[model samples]
Target chain A: MRSGAAVLVEALRQEKVDLLFAYPGGSVIPIFDALYDAPDIKLILPRHEQGGGHMADGYARACGRVGVVIATSGPGATNLVTALATANFDSVPLVAITGQVKTKLIGNDAFQEADITGITRPVTKHNFLVRNVDELGHCLTAAFHIARTGRPGPVLVDIPVDVSMAKTDVPLPTEVHLAGYRPHVEGNLRQIRIAAEAINQAQRPVIYAGGGIIISGASDLLRQLAEKSNCPVTTTLMGLGCFPGRSPLSLGMLGMHGTFYANYAIMESDLVVALGARFDDRITGDVTKFAPGARIIHVDIDPASISKNIKVDIPVVGDARLVLEKLVELVHFVERRDWLARIEGWKKKHPLTYSSGGLRPQYVIEQLDEAAPDDAIICTEVGQNQMWTAQYYKFKIPRTFVSSGGLGTMGYGLPAAIGAQLACPGRRVIDVAGDGSIQMNIQELATAVQNKLPVVVCILNNGHLGMVRQWQQLFYKSRYSGTILEGNPDFVKLAEAYGALGRRVTEAKDVRGALDEALASGRTYVLDFVVEPEENVFPMVPAGEAIDRMIGGMT
Target chain B: MTESKQVISAVVENRPGVLAHISGLFASRGYNIDSLAVGETENPLYSRITVVARGDEAILEQIRKQLAKVIDVIRVTELSGQNFVERDLMLIKVNAPAAKRGEILELAEVFEGKIVDIGVKHIMIEISGPEQKIEAFVELVRPYGIHELVRTGRVAMLRGVSGRPARAAESGEEKKSKN
Candidate 1:
């Protein structure tokens, strides 16, 4: 017989989880104690539960594996709520093992008791509460299976303290038997044929790929389908890097803050093959006017995602990679010179541009793109920095760009960078963060320093919530209410205090040098680049307006 | 695409938090559950949940799809347009003075309600019928000063179905055609 915590560790071993991002607390002492004896799984303690949760999410996104995070009951589990929601929105596979109070004291308001399972129901894909040690192994196995399977998202397992301490001899289940949980992997053959015919016949076809392509590891398949059909490809922000960003056929991104040519191409296209991409409001602009002349073929794993926003002409529900494999085989080559020429004209007329002066964020991103290694993974905090990185940085490979796309979580970058670095030890990891967003989870700097993960965080320090300020400037007559980041800490000193390398670069010429030096430091480094404050992202579609109605970026 | 009441029934794993998961999905998606009822099915491991919601065709499609996506939900069937039978159970307490006792009993007999309990000045009646009938009975008893009323939302099943109820999967094609 073994303790419940020992069985939990054994279950983790069975799942081949080598790295555990966890925070210790009162309810989880038994599990922590078990970890003391278990040397195979490395425990990287995070300063906060939320940071640890993001780390797990980042690890999952970086490597195609289920990330695991553990936290204690009550406040510790509650702290992970934001991270769970973020991962859920992005569909990242993560298993969060949280400690709960003893079963008998669960509803009696015992010390450190929390209804964590209740709190996380809507955010997580699934969750469990382990009532006994006999079922602990099964729950853990099920949690991991649910988290990593089709349409991957976070799953939480709350193990009561007494359950963890109880003795049990039941072996962990190797396979899950969930009758209600089978994901549709192979799409209907008729639907695939219909989609292929639509693709083959269209004069101007565009492939609008999203993060699902990367999640399903269908980037290569996506490229094949796009190339075979001679289609121009555009990606959403999360879908960046799933296709070669610098390719001639690439339309950088679509939706709000997308490239002028990409948006114009999508609007003008006769066929829009949406692969693993949802037509989000940010991308669709005014839904009634979106893709006015186009017949849409949407391919996704989730049936619900199809025709949820924009009406899909051909809906194929299956794994993206599997569907693309079949689609590439069926789709025939077609060339329309007039369509390509029109897109090229738009690209030349309204290229993504910024006024080149005073340490612009776009300039900084371009410099980082140029200076970083080809395979370096770039994580980003939300707001202007995220938009800038999406706009300026050319991600050549899949899994190289990571950001909180769905939830737009601000503090996601630093911890995510750490997780990415851990996942890809040989690759350089950098967090391109805005000053306001970086401060939200700055405490994770300690996690980076202690782990000796050489993650670089380049803060585009504008001393304000730049994105909100831009919206205020454009829509609210530049009142800038509560957008200013007053009394910001000196980031360089903050890095020094955390025993990490720090640099403050104020000039455009110095940006590349700082990035190079920081990448080579072999220590957690912080680069504070004081970028232009009032700069706004361009080719912007004001909310609820048509995609073609641009506010700026007309060269 | 006008808004109408939609009845959705799902077979789900009989687990601790399955109800919460289903209800939470509805609440988070901004779909109001007009009525909801859950009970164990013939199989002990599974429970049947019947939910009535008000939405247009698009909203109804979304609700069905979202409900099917939940891990615990085994199958989802929309019973609104199909030939189905639905009943809601209600236990209502009303003032039963000596003078009004005969009238109340007469009204109960008309509605096929059974007098479950009787107090000195109150009568407890149990009635099971379609939602409209329940509402009608409640309105009729209101003049008698209803003391308390509780209902077990609604439970529905398709008529002449032996194996399994027809799934809402066919509606996907219907939705596409309408679009």
Candidate 2:
């Protein structure tokens, strides 16, 4: 015999859940009491439920494991919605557990009841409401499975107060039997052959990889494919670390903020082999003009990704590793020496360059990379800083570069870095945020400082939302609309207010000084680098266009 | 986008509250179903549901993911290009009086359909097919009025492969025998 709360702990243990980020609440005291004795499960109490959710997502992304977050129902659950949506969009596997109102009080417009499940349905991968204590085991199992399955995302399990208080036998479910759910993990054979045929036959083939390659742990396979086929490779922002950026065959990154040579090669290639990448507007610029002459082979783990855009000649659906292994075995290696030489010449002619005289975002990223511990996790928020980090950071190891790629959500880095820090305590984690994006979730600093989470939030305080302003400057007739901050808080004062250390950097030479001081603080800290205004991420391909049409200072 | 209808099969837990979650999800998302069917699964612990609707690719993806997220929902599958067995049972009232009753009976016999009830004016008949045939049959029976009738929701499976449960069971049995 076990209490409902005890059963919940045991169920989580049975699922091999090792860590949990949580906040206590009125409706869920029983579960907290049960957690006191479960030393096997390490629980880190976060200052805010929103931070807990993000931390969970960061842990999941950093560790390549399921992240668990718990909160009392109502406000606790509501705070987690944005984090859940962020996780859902980025495909990070997170489990958000909330304590619900008592069963009888659930639909009676209970004080804390705001239809949490309804509010989160569109954003979360799935959600559950546990009515019976006996079904808690089943629900827990399904939540983990759903969270960590194909193209993993967040799942919410709303446990009512009574359900967590009632007693039951608490037998662990033997297995899950989901008739409608079967993830296609194995590669499609016909499509795989078609891909191999396309690769072997193409005259000027290039492999455009995405974050899926990194998520699938297919970096080695991707490199082998590129090396063996003598194909040039470029990656999306999220696709960093899938290939060695320093490699001779590497085209760096291809997108709005991609290298000019990379963009040019992708556009001019006769055959484009896109692996684990969605041709987002940022990457493709204008879809109609994207790789118009190239016969495309899109290989991804998700089926719906195939031919959804850019009508693929061959669409291989399966794990990139599994698919690439088969492709390597079937196809003979051939070198496109002429194509490679031509690309190298093009790169030598038009390289990714920035103004050498001014305080540059790229300079900040390069300096941070040099200052931080080797192979440290650099999480970035969306803006000019995010693009600059993507372009400049040299990530040698896998899972080192994390960001909001698919959703382009702002305020992602601070919480994500906190989560990443919790995931790998010994490793350094840094959140690179623009001044505008940082304020969105600046409250999370208290979450970090309260828990002594050694996460560094480096704020590129450019005064205006860098990315939005850049778009306005280029396309919006330079009429700034709600993009600039009126009374920006003294970031240094804000950090001190949150019980965290703070630093300010105003000079071009002080970037290294600010980064070093923040990292050395050995506590939750902020380094407000007051950067130059009117800076823009360059080598941009205008919307719905090809990479060849890149226009910027560098291009 | 030509709005071609789609058949989605969902497996959910067999419980009274499961329907609330599923129906609530569909309602909140403003997704309307053309026909929905729910029945107990081969495993008594669960139930299998099939839904039919018309939507484009993005909507189908949203629906599949949304269904998969429902707590009681065990699995979700959108039967797209995969070779799968699909069927729907529809009851139509044919205009069969004494004179044309023989012809209607012949047609029912050819299609293996049964005429459940008959009146002085109309005959109630049930027919099933792979959507296309069902549409053709309905068109042929259009000479008669379709009275209040219900169609079992679209149920589907991959064309030539074993389902996940069966495969898992076989693996489990293999391990058991080895032990």
Candidate 3:
């Protein structure tokens, strides 16, 4: 007899998934038992279901593969919602498996039964309900295929308890056919040729690369294009890891908090070739004034993404790796030294810097980075710490920077770090958090301590909703409405309360030492850096305005 | 006939102001909806809705975009090609209605469709192709009056993809409607 749980495990193994980040529950007891005996696929028990989901997301984004998460039905599956939404917005591929009470109990509102499929319908690319163990192979194959293809997003499979327990003769699917799921990977040669000519003739060309560069696993190709053509590159927040932060042509995150030089360069460039970057509102502050002089060429893997956000002069519909390779083949390297010098002048004249006021926030991240051991993965909670880490951290390789970009999910960092640490067992995972946002997923700290996962959580304790507060300061006249955060948990005691190491650092000198010691200690550590909450990230562009109108930078 | 576009924004309580209400409005009156997009706006307490419907050039400017201005609504913009932008989602299944199966499959292939389920009498095709293709395929398959049709109303991004990105520099509504 083929048990549902066994069948599911068999199917996952067939898909070549070696690991599952998950939390067990009453409904999924059978699957848990099956996992206990399974020798091939390792299961990581997340402290929280939300963390499980985020681990999947982080893994997917980090590895550029479909991340898998397993949870029990009802609340267990419900917690996966935020991560699924995060993946959907960011176009990350995740396969979430949730165990239901039983198929018969569906619609009856049985104990621990929630229509997770229905709940996740809009947010997920699609979902499935396994009625029998017999369908496990087909269902899993479809789940992985859907999760990993075309504008890749999250997919859910809700397996009933009975289905997981009931046995049947296994009939593994050797092949799966989805007539609807054909994703066009090869570049349309006509569009490619047209784009090549545009680039071949461009006087002042710029390559605006996005996360697709990393997703396509074509950083080498992107670097080749940039170096060969001497094309200056700008990236969205998602595209941060694509170009080396130290590269000469690299212009840092270009959007609401983007560099002044990056935005100005984009606006003034005669040619803009967008690779996988969605022209988000935060990036295109004032669309009317954005790249007005540019002849735009957009190359993307998703057909829907083509001209979905920005108007295209020449649209190349293909994967970035394939498309970039072809373009490099057809075109010769050409650089305007005069133009490169101009951009360098802008970069040199307007280099990014932060002042160490009464309390320096930038110092906190630096300290955390210094303290963190080599191969330590930093998962950043959204808001100021997230941006600061993105700007300041030296992420030398892929999967190193794991945080929410598309969704700007505030609670993602702590749980995502928990997830990443599970994947890379040897690496020290740190969650650089803002005190305000940390509260959202602070429950996971117990997970970290319980699982014996040594996560060095550095809380940049700025006592306000710092990002929004900055906006209100710059644009809304510092009315200081609801931005002030007060009467929060004593995090030091809180970490100790959870039986973990915790510390509060008020001075800059103490921060590095505290972090270094914490990282050196094997147990989960929480360092609450009492940074001056009033400091703001500079070069802020007011919404609905031109990017060039960035305020607050000395440059 | 002269045509004008209306932009109507609505703030609906997130509970159950679903299709039944929207359908009741359109079914009760013969108002054709050109485009509609609904999402949680700045505040999660309410959903912000923007619809661009075309018709009746002579109606009151306030009245045309006013249907959504009911108590549930907090804002409105009866947008058009000139002032506003709109996009809609369509999942269409044209005739594989018994007689011409293979030929219809070829057409469906051209439109990039999936045959979801097949019956002796009809085949249910799933397609997220262009609206023009949907309309054209529906008309092409119309010797067999369509059995069922459902479309998510249009969501608009003002001219360009991003709000502050350069405006689309104007194109035919039909051409711009390609997405």
Candidate 4:
């Protein structure tokens, strides 16, 4: 006979979980004790449950594995709400194991008792509440299976403390039999043929890719389909690295805050082949008028995502890689010189640019991209820093750029970088963060230092909530009410206090040097680049407006 | 795209949180649920949920797809376009004075409703029929004054030989055999 906690650990071993991000509490001490004897699974503790959750998200995105996070009940589980929503929105595979109050005390207002399963229902792909020790092993295995399969999202398994402590001799189930859950992986032949015919008959075709490309490991197939069809490609923010950013046929990103030429191309295209992309509001500003002239062919694994936002003429439901593989096989080469010339002209006329006088965030990101290794992974906090990195950095490979795209969670960077660093031990990981966003999870610095993970955090310290400030400047008549961040701590000293290296650069000339030193320091480092406060992300399509209509920096 | 009512039937694993999952999906997506009914199907491990919602074609398509995406939902079918039979059961307590007792009984007989209980001052009638029939009956009895009324929403099934088979049963049997 073995304790339920030991059985749980054995199940983790069965799942081949090498790294587990967790935080201990009163309800989880039994499991923590079991973890003490299990040497195969390395448990990394975070200061807060939220940080641990985001770390798991980043680890999943980086390694294409089911990221696991464990926390106690009540507050510990609630703290993971934001991270779970973030992962759900991005469709990152994550399994969250939370310790619940004892089964007897449940629903009786026991201490540290919360209905975690019910609370996380909408945010998670699936969830379970284990009522007994026999259900514990099955729930865990099923959680991982559901998290990693079929459009992949976070799954939560809430195990009561008594169940975790109860001894059970039942062997762990080797198979999952979820009768209601089965993902459709193969594309219909008729749909593929119809899509191929549409592509062949089109003159101006643009390929729009999203995070699904990375999730499906279809970047290569996507590139093949694009090249075979001679189609120009544009990606959403989450799809930054799915296509080589430096390729001639690449339109870096398309949508709000997208490249000027990319929006123009999308607006003017005769046909748009969307692969694994949901037409989110950010991508389809003024949905009624978005890509008005384009005949859209949307291919996604989720049937609901096909026509959720914008209507599609042809809908192909299947795995991204499988569909793209068939599409690559069926599509013939086509050359549209006129379409290519028009796009090139627009690209030359409206290249992404900013005023180069003061210390600019764009310039710092460019410098970092130049100094970083070819395979270095770059993560970003939300706001101006994320948009700038998406614009300036050239991502040549998939799984190299990690950011919170759908939920737009701030403070996701530092902890995500820690997870990425651990996921890819040899690759240099960097988190391009904003001054306002970094403070939300700055306490994660201790976790990174304690783990001795050499991850660099490049903070663009502009002393304001830069994205909101930009919106207020343009739309709200420059009434920057609460956007300004005041009395911020000296980040360099804070880093030193955590026993990590830190540097502050206030000049444009020193940006490159600071990045080089931080990258070479072989320690957890923070490079704070004091950037221009008023600088705004341009080529902006104001919310609820047409994608082609812009406010500033068109040229 | 004009808005029209559509009936959706979903077979799902019978569990504690399944109802919340289905209802929450509707609430979150801004889909209006006119009425909903759920009960155990032929298989004890599964439940069938019938939902009446108002939406256009696009909205209906989205509702069907989203429902199917729920992990516990085994299958979702839109019973609007097909020939289906829908029924709602209601229990209504109407004030029946000595003078109106005979009239109330006569009205219940016309509607094929059964008089479940007779109180000192009221008559409780159990009525099960299509929504329109039930509504008409309620309106006819409005003159007598209703004390209390409760409806079981709507439950629907396809008509004729085109009914939904015991697919849930087959799956359960498959699992049993596998074990």
Question: Which of the two, 2 or 4, has more TM-score?
Answer: 4
Stretches > 4 Å off in candidate 3: A367-375, B1-179
Docking class of 3: incorrect
DockQ of each: 0.33, 0.14, 0.03, 0.41
- Candidate with more favorable, higher TM-score: 2 or 3: 2
State in Å the error of residue A217, model 3: 0.6
- Chain A TM-scores in order: 0.99, 0.95, 0.94, 0.99
TM for every model, in the order presented, reads 0.96, 0.83, 0.76, 0.98
Which regions of candidate 1 are displaced past 4 Å?
B94-103, B118-123, B138-147, B164-179
Please estimate how well model 1 matches the true structure, expressed as its whole-model Cα lDDT. Answer: 0.91
Which residue pairs collide in model 1, if any?
Answer: none
| Deviation in Å, model 2, residue B173 alpha carbon | 16
lDDT of 3 by residue, A60-88 (tens): 77667788999999999998999899988
> Could you tell me the TM-score of candidate 4?
0.98
| For model 2 chain A, the run of ten residues with the poorest summed lDDT | A174-183
- Indicate which candidate wins on DockQ: 4
